[model samples]
Each structure stands twice: as structure tokens, then as C-alpha cells.
Target: MSSAPALADDCRFDDRAGLLAMSPEAFDNGPDEGWDALAERAGCQLEIAELFTAYRQQAKAAGHAGLAWHEATMRADAGQRDPAIALMRLTYKPHGADPEGWNHYVDATIAFLDDDLPALKRARARLAKLPMPLGNAREQGDDERPAGRPQLKIVDALIRCMYQPYALASESCPEP
Candidate 1:
């Protein structure tokens, strides 16, 4: 797969004011053209991939869950499900008494992949009951708090809910 783009040598969104002024709309305006320009200006897949991965990891650590997820999701290989599934599993693992949000994530992922109305409906129902703090924060444009009680609880719950479904699905469909 092609790696993410690198920033231009003269790109000047280095400060807070510059960042704030940089609208998300700009990114959305012409992604392919922008990426092509960036690729042309900064030539090196390794450098671009490293920069993209670093940004994604930093976003995750900084509670910018939406950005982190978006980065991962966008780069997911079309024929590869393992990485996506692994990510879902990691996000929902439980820590203590609480259930993580793994279940909701898994359900959502399955719904996204399957395109089955029944599965989608079931996933949506389960999702409605889950706290889904990270999902909620992303929707509200609020940064997720560092991993803690609420995060753990949601993660655990998600894990529990998704476990059986994931297992069953995997069993039914072996990877080639």
C-alpha cells in the first residue's frame, strides 16, 4: 500500500496559531491532489510512513482518539483484516472489574464489513447500550481522557460483548 504523505519542506503549520487556522476543511478539500503534491515535494516512503505512524501514536497518547482512529482506519489495507481486528481487540481489552468498549467496536466493525442489515441492527442495539466514551468524545470533538476507570470499564464491556462474535466469525471464515 502507498504510505501517507510527508509535509512540505516549507510547510509552516508549526505553531498553535498556524495549526488553529489550518481548517480540517483544507485537508478534506482535495486529499488526493494534496497527497500527490506532498509526495512529489517530499520523496521517501519510509520517511512518510514514519512521520504518519509517529503522528498517529502521538494523537492516541494525547487523547485525540478520533484522529488516531482515523489515521489507522484510512490506511487499513483493503484485503487485510488482521490489523483492523487487532486494533479493535487492543482498544477493548479490560483492566479490572469493568468491561471495555471492545464489544461495541467489534460490532461496529462487523457491521461495517458485513453490510448485513440484521447484523447492523444488532450491532447498533448493542452500541446504544454501551457507554462508548471514546466514540462519544470523538463525536463531540472532545479529547479522550487518558486511560482510567471509565475508559477501562468501557473497554472491558466492549471486549466481553465482542469476544464471542469475533470468535464465531473467525471460525466460520478462515483466512486464506
Candidate 2:
């Protein structure tokens, strides 16, 4: 409260020397110690969206495929739908894992961004029909999706909540 930073104030980072000096070891963690709590300490800070996009790009080029995905979602959240859709389309894409489920998920996400509920519904239906993967290939456990692709669930919830912004509807819609 009294000292909370406004979310809309800016995406700020600074102390390049300090951050680089700290590197991977200096990340903040929540009290759970299992979550990466975002850094709140301030000595010198700066805010600019360009740094984020560029950081994602550099990380992706260095083979962080998932960070690139995060960038796409970031763009979409910023209401930059076209760029997000384009970036999503160009990804190495889901043609690898459960291609059917993943591809449909991508289509549905684009549809959601486009506000094409019909297309979203169609894609969600396709995903629902596919054999579910055991768990997200990356991580498992409590986040394990017992029924189907987490993406499918997200689309379904988006539809259930009438596709409101994920943040707006996530309480009713749950996952993002």
C-alpha cells in the first residue's frame, strides 16, 4: 500500500552494472521461495517497453523458445493484437509436440485476439477432440492438467467468460 508502485507507472529497470553483476543469482523470490517475486528494490530505475521486447528477442535467439511465447502474450495484453498474432504465427510452432492440440490452441489464441469467437470456438472444438498430453511438457505436478491441453481450458474459459481480457475474467476463467 502506502509504498506500492503503480502498475501503470512504467516497466522500469536500471543499475545495469548491478543487475549484470548479480546475473541469475540475484532474482527476487516470494516468501514461498518457490516463485520468482519481481524486483521491487530501487536505487536507479528506468522504464521503457522497448527493452522488454528486445530482451525477449535476444533470449529467444539464444534458444529460450518460451520467453518468446511470453513476449507474444505481452504484446497481446498491450492490445497490440496484430503484432502478437504475427509473432505467434512465425514461431517454431506447435508442429512438434501434440501438433493437433497445440496448433489448434494457436489458432484459438489468434482468434481470441481477433475477436473471432466463431473461429475460436472451432479451434477449441478441435483441441477438445485431440488426445490430451500427460502434462505440459515443461513442468508438472499441481499444475498438471488432468483433462486436456491447458490451452484448451483457457480457450474454453475465455468462451465461458465471453472472452473478456484474461485478467478481467481469470477469477471466473482461472488460468491465463
What is the C-alpha local distance difference test score of each model?
0.40, 0.52
Per-prediction TM-score to the true structure, in the order listed: 0.33, 0.62
Candidate 2: pairs in clash: 170-174
Q: What lDDT, from 0 to 1, does candidate 1 have? A: 0.40
Give me the runs in candidate 1 sitting further than 4 Å from their true place: 1-68, 77-81, 93-102, 114-117, 130-176
Candidate 1 RMSD computed on C-alpha atoms after optimal superposition onto the true structure = 12.9
- Compared with the true structure, what per-residue lDDT tens digits does model 2 show for residues 29-105? 22412112222222111122233355544332454454345456555655567877876775545456555466787
Best by TM-score: 2
1-176 per-residue lDDT for model 1 (tens digits): 23234455443223423322333433223464222233333223333333334544432344333433333333332223455445444444344433444455555664544434466456556555655555555566666544323433333333344433332232232322
User: Residue 19's C-alpha lDDT in candidate 2?
Assistant: 32
